[model samples]
Target: MSESDFTVRSVPMLLSRNKSQEWRDIVLLRSGMLMRFLKTHNLLINVEPFDENGNVKDDLVIKKSHLTDDGLELFKKVIPGWSQYLDKGGDVNNINRLIKGLEKIRNQ
Candidate 1:
């Protein structure tokens, strides 16, 4: 998917002033789901871990967009069965696929 297709919008909250913190929390909570979706589409470019304060924690980066053949092979190995559960089509299948994929990933 393109970056534009994945854009997240902000909503005004009457009771919350810490929008940055809220965004970080939301991202942290949904990171796994986002990773799964990216893997399914073979579009995962990089994964950077961060602390609660949004500080980068590690230097390990996987830029699939710039990967060579060997790098792609390694990435595939690292993310085995990445899109194995993504073939189901309709709305029901889509929901089932997501639930099953999340359960499998969480279990692992």
Candidate 2:
């Protein structure tokens, strides 16, 4: 049920639900909480487990875009090669990705 759970799908709800700012706040909080819980259980989806080439493995759980800054920070602590994957001099693509990821999390 993790894939279809309300906490996983935020923009559109299959069930009738409140749309107030207060409700949205609660939803965001719950979503964060859910991610934390999943992380501890090793059930969260995302790019972890680098391949032999030191890149992300072919697997996913929670998406990076859906994560809050705190969530990403927490998740990063668990990954082995997160730093190696980032920080190329002229190639600021990963930097931009980090910024966008953080912004999207904060905006939510």
Candidate 3:
């Protein structure tokens, strides 16, 4: 599959099933799924196993356009409120506050 086709297939799988509280895990899972899909379609380049330290042995050289398109589509579906929560970066205190605020609104 082409990058676009891989992206289309992967995003829905990610958006439909994730319950991770960590934003980093969410992104990693999305990226890993996309990479796996690309590999399955024989579209990825220089596939390598992770090292003992759990780092990729080689760099993944994908175009920014493909990455941007895939990430934007995935986030749009999986985390509609992600930007509102992550706009300030690693603001878990604010995430807590925001959740409480939404709870208050919901209880009204």
Residues 30-87, model 1: lDDT tens digits: 3444344445544444543344555433232334453334334433443233334332
Report every candidate's CA lDDT.
0.38, 0.41, 0.41
Candidate 2's residue-wise lDDT over 14-94, tens digit each? 112775776555444433433334444444454343346643232323555545445555456432132244322233123
TM-scores of all candidate predictions against the true structure: 0.24, 0.30, 0.30
Model 1 regions more than 4 Å off? 1-23, 45-108
Off by over 4 Å in 3: 1-21, 47-61, 64-108
Candidate 3 to native Cα RMSD, angstroms: 13.7
Superposed Cα deviation of residue 46, candidate 1 (Å): 6.4
lDDT preference between candidates 1 and 3, better one: 3
Candidate 3 worst ten-residue window by lDDT: 55-64
Q: What RMSD value applies to candidate 1? A: 11.9
